[model samples]
Target: MSRHPDLQKFLDRYFMVFLAGYFLSLYAMAGTFSLVWSTYCRDCSREINYPLSLGVLVVTLVTAHAAVVRGRDWGVWMVAALCIGSVVFLLPTYGFRPHMGIFLSIIVVALLALLVLNSKRYRAMRVLLAEYRNKRQVERASKAQRPKVRRSR
Candidate 1:
């Protein structure tokens, strides 16, 4: 039995859907916010765009999630990088400023991402997915190389 059967099931089924949906929803919300704030938001705001920033954030997080779900060690490190980058990108925007509450929430979200990434279930899912992929590739190669046979009718 696998250590993380549920995680493996989800990975095998709709990992891409979850990743894509989460990213698209985040971007859609950010874009909506930008449109609404364009007139009321007078602060310099660094002339930086919020939609793209959040979109990239979603990309990093989802990429990490996918990497982990697919049993890639590189993605494990990426999750950490995403957490660190989230702090760097969001700190100035939400930290030690007027909006202290927002900063805390962002920190919590980053922490949650790291927590999920490091979960035993997630790690187990990664291993299972790697083995499944290897098995599939091997089967495909063998089928392709198999010799054809025909009998007289």
Candidate 2:
């Protein structure tokens, strides 16, 4: 357990709120994109785009879960990159028009870059995760070094 239990609690609460908000925004953007695609490309074949979009969504969500729930720094970078890619893709598709999906994507990217990345709380969380990881490693090493005693049958 962290020495500052109250800070840990606050961090947990903040992450929970961030996770929920990010999930909802991402889901809404996906739905909006699907609707827009269907509306705009009625006669086009749906063989490639839908599956690609679904894959991206899945990857984004998984990385998000890892970053927020598991406290993995790599996950945070992956999500940030994906979100930036989303914004780029959205802007070209919308032709600079102000669409809700694009706005949501931009907001997500902004929040991640401005609020979450480089924040003191996030750094503290990373330190805590590192400590936990080190502790686990030590435990595993100790267990591996222990010799098993055999009993006579």
Candidate 3:
């Protein structure tokens, strides 16, 4: 289960991709939320910003895949933080105007669904799980190597 040292560099590459995707998703999600919020505030009806939101969500999902492939803890945390932020941002601000919150909620659902089904995340998770197991094995092995105390005569 021990990964080759050589693979660390490759892992770094995927992690970088994941971070890039994370930032991109943030920008896109914020932009889409803003766009919908702005348009609805001005027009007083649901506009067609779903496509733009979906596009950004798609990118974010793909980046989620990259993170899974790398098995990065920070990546998972980043995704979790994003989801939490979306929920926070999507909350209704005023009693009369709630379209923006609605729009954000819909996109959050879509993004969450995508994250659940993401294949890349699964692969990366596998690798990460293996790494954890390997580390555990090494710890056990080291413990076993320690000399036992002699019995008293």
Clashes of each: 0, 0, 1
Report the lDDT tens digits of candidate 1 across residue range 1-153: 765987577666656544543343343334323433443353537356655655675676677657656556787687666555555555455322434554556556566555655666655656777787788789999999999798889
Residues 18-75 of candidate 2: C-alpha lDDT, one tens digit per residue: 5544564465446446545644555766799767867877877676656654656676
Q: For residue 101, what is the lDDT in candidate 3?
A: 60
lDDT values for all models? 0.57, 0.60, 0.56
Best by TM-score: 2
Top lDDT prediction, candidate number: 2
Off by over 4 Å in 2: 1-14, 17-44, 47-49, 96-114
TM-score of 2: 0.63
- The order by descending lDDT is 2, 1, 3
Q: Model 1 reaches what TM-score against the true structure?
A: 0.56
Candidate 1 positional error at 46, Å: 10
As for lDDT, the candidate ahead, 2 or 3, is 2
